[model samples]
Target: MSDNFPPPPPEQPQPEPERPVPVQPSPWAAPAAPPGKQRTGLIVTLAVGGGLVVAGAVVALVYAAMSSVQDSIALPPRSETPYSEPYEEEPYEEEPYAEGPSATEADAKKDVTITACTRDPQIGWQSAKVKVVNGSSTTASYTIMMEFLDEDGVKVAEGGAGVVDLEPGASAVKKAQGLGEVPPGTTCRIGDVWRTPSDRSGS
Candidate 1:
């Protein structure tokens, strides 16, 4: 018998003691977070920085728009002069009458004189007669204005008469008629006398 028992199973090698694997952290795995307080502080810092960048961009855009609007608008020019009050006009004053004798009074004194005046009543008219004397040296024509006065000395009617070509120092009768009735107690007087150069031959 050749020791045919399967050669006694080769002496099995004694099992080596199992060694523990060194646990190396994986490269892609997320790192373990720190304490709760430190982690909250890191998140707050990142948020504040992001907000600042966004605010800066908004401010830049607003400033550019405002600049463009200001350049496009036109403003009116300012005046250098100060304000002044309106001009006012002065009030007007009237001139007073001059003190002197009128032209008619001077002509009457130098040319003729009235000697007598009379008024007589006719059918439908009251006739006035005036006696005039030419005081000037030359032959003259005369006009006599007569006024009729009532008893109270108030004038009621007036008329005029003309004498043509009376010689110097000559007397002439001139007559006129008033159309209305002559009231009672009425008297007549010469009101005015005017004289001019005569065209007729004088005696």
Candidate 2:
């Protein structure tokens, strides 16, 4: 019996299975960006299958919408220049005047004559140029008044100027200004004149 089975060959030595190799961990690397962020507006291709007779690919189409973007900001309104009007001085009623003119003043006004009546180009007020002659026999000073009147003779403005130390029978020119702004076609004239005697004897 032993010859027939021929004692089983001595068990051959079995080589030890190879120890699993510990693959060195690849150097730490940054993870890829999420699909939503990376795949936008891009075309992608994919393949599936190893057992089929013909090579085939699974085509998945991901549509990404594209649109134009515009940036704008609101701004405040622009500033404009303000309106301007003609200038005016104090009102005519604010002037100092008595109820009535004295006899000498009324007589002196006759000696004062208005030469030119016009509007001031710079201040836009009425003005009058008057010639005052000291017709009395003594040295005197005179204050002459100007009145601005509308076409209907309505007084609109009044002003005055003084001529001092005028000798007897001597003449002088002075400008009288109007206080208020008069209308178009308005007239200016000498309103009144008052004389002050400084010396009894002619000087």
- The best candidate in terms of lDDT: 2
For model 2, the run of ten residues with the poorest summed lDDT: 60-69
Q: Locate the minimum summed-lDDT window of 10 residues in model 1.
A: 96-105
Which lDDT tens digits does candidate 1 get at residues 91-173? Answer: 87866434322224555544544444444544434456666677768777776677777789988887788877778888776
TM-score of each: 0.41, 0.46
lDDT tens readout by residue for model 2, 162-201: 8988999999999888887777777977766778777545
TM-score of 2: 0.46
